[model samples]
Target: MGISKHSIETLKQTLDILDVIGSVVELKKSGSNYVACCPFHDEKTPSFVVSPVKGFYHCYGCGVGGDAIKFLMEYEKLSFVESVEKIAAIMNFTLEYETSYEKKPDFALLDEVMRFYQKNLLNHKPSLDYLASRCVANSSIEKFALGYCGASFETIKFLNAKGLNKTEALEYGVIGKDSVWEYARFSDRIIFPIHSPSGKVVGFGGRTMSGANAKYINSPQSKIFNKSKLLYGYYIAKDKIYKQKKIIVCEGYLDVIMLHQAGFDYAVATLGTALTKDHLPLLAKGEPKVILSYDGDKAGINAAFKAAKILAASGKDGGVVIFANGMDPADMVANKQINELSDMFANPVPFVDFILQHIAKNYDLNNPLQKEKALAESTQFLHTLSPVLQEEYKPTLAHLLSLPIHLIGSKRLPQHNPLTFTTPTQEIAESVLIKTLLEKPEWIDFALEYIDISLFVYKRAEFTKLVANEHQDSALIALMINERIRPINDLPSLKEHLRLFITQAYTQILSQIPHYTGMNLQEKSILMKEIKTKILQLKKGELLPYVSSSTF
Candidate 1:
């Protein structure tokens, strides 16, 4: 609910800045106001100054300048509404809500509902058996307040007995439909209670024991519970997160529980959603290093990549660990691989490295054109980071693309030019290759056997038009009229470029062999051997006959 504007104005007009900031910061008299070390950052020289007259504070060191309300938002990590409410409460002011949030999400009713779910688990043998099978100890279950809510119309009866109604149940997502009493939102599932940062139970996460339902489902968004803003098991992990100055984010509730049970208690999971920018605020608190642990699957890898980009861009310290094979944290813990798991956590792929690798993986390093695209993508992502980070990761990006550092973002890569954009050897080779194809159409069929369409990125459409026998496009016209259109006239020089493209394509295919996790050992071994033999032949200046498809 939003606070009334008049109430906010009153607090801004009457509240004393000195009293508000002085309560948190150790301020001393400075001529007419106060001065202290900046609380937002580390500074020993006391560059932070507070002005009672202007009712604001500014730190010369970090340049974080703000008023009392802004100070609370930064220092305490509170939202604007939270900051206003906090200071208003301190001044004994009754802040009016813009919308009547008269009936808040029935906190007491939620507590009662959780207690009933816990009671239901103790009696449900199937739920208990499932827990036992997963190696979940009774103590761990009780400690986490794990529970069961079966489909028996029992939850409705119990809530009715407690004098609660459908409005509260539907408001918090206990029942599927709000208009009438119906089946529970969660049935035949193991319930994991999600808590507020203050350790109050606010919502539920259900893990389906039956394979018929989605693997997991979280409580619907409510007045107080936003899954994107809440992390599972955070209430338990917060202390360790602060102590160790690290947090391990995972994909599921069992992953967090297993990690905690395995003695790695600084682990939490997103509530059935990928980590988002909304999560950054809570993650910013305690200044902890963020580690993301995910399953070894396509979705998991994509999630980890997105999270790494966000964390890296936001300047959060962290790394990523994508479990190999089909393994996950829960599987590893159950398999008694604690040492391996700990080692993985201790030395995860750093955020910068993970991001660079993920982007590079999408393009073939052997293809000169793909390499340029890869470099451009890597540079774009790098620009989002701090300048120091951008500079630091540039060499790393260069190494990933097998290029010299000077070539990356050296100059803006031109769009319509084929031969004029000098620099970046890949572009030079591409322009040479395309000029060869355009001027000497006789060599087109010969080169078609060696090069993929992706080998000509800067002038790919022009190259495609040339291959298709349509020579009237403006881009091709521009290439033809350009002064640098001196195409290779000899077969030997053209053969040299074709050999490089062929060898790189083979090498790229070879490099991705191990990543074909779905392939059998024998099949992968045969494919690797064939690709290696072809690459070896190409390196020895031997030409192989093959039809190159449009795709690489």
Candidate 2:
């Protein structure tokens, strides 16, 4: 429901910001206001300031300044409406709506429908037996409010008896239609009720226990239900999440329940889709860390990579945990692998390391072509991060690839010709001479004697590393060089190729330099002469003298 402006004003007026915020953060009086260490970011000293008179907070350390609603929304990952409702509930105040909401299915009706499913589970022995077979305790079932939907029109009948017509049932996804007629949306399956952040049952997810082609089905999007915005078990797990300051994001409803039953009460899962940006706000609220516990399948692996990228780019503190031996969180718990599961939760892989390893696995680092492709792909992802994060990681990735730090951002770095306009084939050709030299490490001195390392354009760091005989892997070093075969016996052919590649690099560098209109005529003449001299040297087939020191 949409709240009125008057209700919001009254809400702020009636409640004290210090009181509400103080519940979660310990605050000491600092003059007219109170202060605490900022919850939004890491800091040693108190920087988060709160003003009871203003009814707002400002974290000078993180530059996050907002009102009570904004603070609750960010701190708890609650939606605007959810935040207001929470505050209203705390203040024992009823909210007033300015605009009338449409007469849609209310939570009372949803609650009644949930009761029908729960009753069905009680009578259905087979579903209960199935839960037992999966090691779900009776207490766990009751705590999760688990239910079953039989393969019949019982849900439709139950709702119809309570004055909810078939149209409303269809709208709520309680029923779906085929070519012939309509049937219950979920049947012959264990049902899991998905709740709103405020603890109201808004939708359902049903998993087939029999031989059904579709393993699971969820309620379609509706006024109350959006799978993207909701997390399974989140409402129930919110208290534990707040207490533990951590949340385990898994891939299935059972994974969440099993984890919770195993005493990890802060576990939650995405409704039916892979974790998306819509879920981040909710996940960010309860803690600084979120553990993505995905299955060890190909799909799960890909999803983990994507989830890692999203979390890293958004600057969220989290890690990805993929189960080994094809086991999921539920499987691990079922098999009594508590130690392994606990260890993963206790020490999740850091996000940067996880993504780098994932990208590296996609290519054969032994193969020059694949290694180059992998590094290019990895560097592109790194560029999406903030500058501070990007710089912090550059040296680490460079050291991993045995390349120069400059090469990590070679495409963006001004010293090297911007590779933005170069075709992949052109870039590969440019890297061939370097790759061949890396394979014949002794040949690096001869090549360096002729061409300056800075003018090598691509893979300058890897080239320099090879020349210096740094600790390296042959296969990874090969990938940084072009994967093309080298004819070492044909010195003339090799020299011709090297000459052409170096010429092209200089030509590109010259073309890319901007003409400075601010330069005086004498300075412009000197610049033009310098550029022409290099072109003339290239044209005369004479190797230009080393122009600058090594870039990497």
Candidate 3:
């Protein structure tokens, strides 16, 4: 079920617009308003202005102007419902109506827990020593929001004070309780807080400080956090990834931290799960290329293959980076071979190449039978791409398979050419008249007196609505607001095409409405038949006969 409109409005009212934005961006006081660097676009000077009084923000640079809800939608990249729920958490307002929808908790408790962990990291000596041994620098720890969860029930008490009950705490997987006894789930471990893209602390990944069993422990799935959707270091590296147009997908938290420390800013890691579609758009922002840097193991290769299928299906350019001599990025960085790691990132192989390599390793490529099988498998992979992309890559696949390129047929492509129009000559003439009306609405009434309404095929509703309302001035705006029509920005030539189409449709419709003051019924019927035949000929691309059968 969807969130009720009443609940959405209530959330809008309870959550202060300024407070929500201020958390992510460092908004400064400017008269009664606030201003910050626009997160949506890059600029040296601040063009993003927020007016708390008006409850709206306008970016002069990008020309994006909207309310708080719109701001959250654009900035966090969330849907309407997600934005409402996020705001609801900030205001401590309960969204009461129970439904099958997952119940997300207030982030206040998680925020408190993160702060506690951060403080513990600063104060604890053993945690500091452990990090030092692992070559995790002090600066890196603070930058990545790393901390330590003490091995005791003190974390439980800290969370309890923030109004989180035992059940609620356990639900987050931060603590465990058995018969009124509670203990920390993560003990003597270097903590990495898994945050949502919006920067809400969702869960934790703890590496054992004692070098004990289970090298890593992660927070169980909670309402707000899905392991598949959450990427480690995304909160920090998102902007860099956008700017660089590339992202390095490493295997572990330490791998991410090490890479970041080594001056590679655009890197993130999965939360102990294989790559999923949830990671695609997040990584694909600004058209960034992805490089999967999974460890060199049988399990890692298997994971990479799975990731390749997803990336290929998503229609994004990505590649796999196999470490030399079975070394992970973290090991390479720690062992002072950071340059080698950087080289691997610099010259990444395409995901398709990696998949083919994997196939060649298992199959006997010299055997004609094996080569044929390999080509068949690769062809199926290539066929999954869009027609445009398929055409571009077909030659490359032919080369890889050692086959003549022309042998691959291209019949699967769609036939629509968005660049061209197929309207008839009379339709173009009518369109020109409509354009004149759009440019000057006063002419609409003058044309309506002489023109009939039946000549237009499409845009009948829009024309009729405007004529009935005597709102010729708003004809363009009416069409723009219609859901049936695609957004002007989405179509490349929409502006030019819309002007032409609307003008013609308007003229044709206006020319169709009969002027009945002088015309007899029989004469009007003959004129109507001629106009209908003209429309049919125009639509079907058929030539009108020189004379009618009656005339012959």
- Give the per-residue lDDT digits (tens) of candidate 1, residues 420-506: 245665555666777677778888988877776766546677778888887655455444434444567899989987788667666
The C-alpha TM-scores of every prediction are 0.60, 0.60, 0.65
Global CA lDDT computed for model 1? 0.79
Residues 26-137 of candidate 3: C-alpha lDDT, one tens digit per residue: 5544555666678889865566776675566766567676667777888889998788777776555666454656565557677778889999999889888877876888
Worst 10-residue lDDT window, candidate 2: 411-420
Q: Tell me the spans in candidate 1 whose CA falls farther than 4 Å from its real position.
A: 1-105, 178-181, 410-552
Task: Identify the leading candidate in terms of lDDT.
Answer: 1
Model 1, residue 490: what's the lDDT?
Answer: 96
Better of 2 and 3 by TM-score: 3
Compute the lDDT for candidate 3.
0.70
What are the lDDT figures for the candidates, one per model?
A: 0.79, 0.74, 0.70
Name the best candidate (by TM-score).
3
Task: Give the per-residue Cα lDDT of candidate 2 at 19.
Answer: 44
Residue pairs with backbone overlap in model 2: 368-479
Clash counts for the predictions, in order: 0, 1, 13
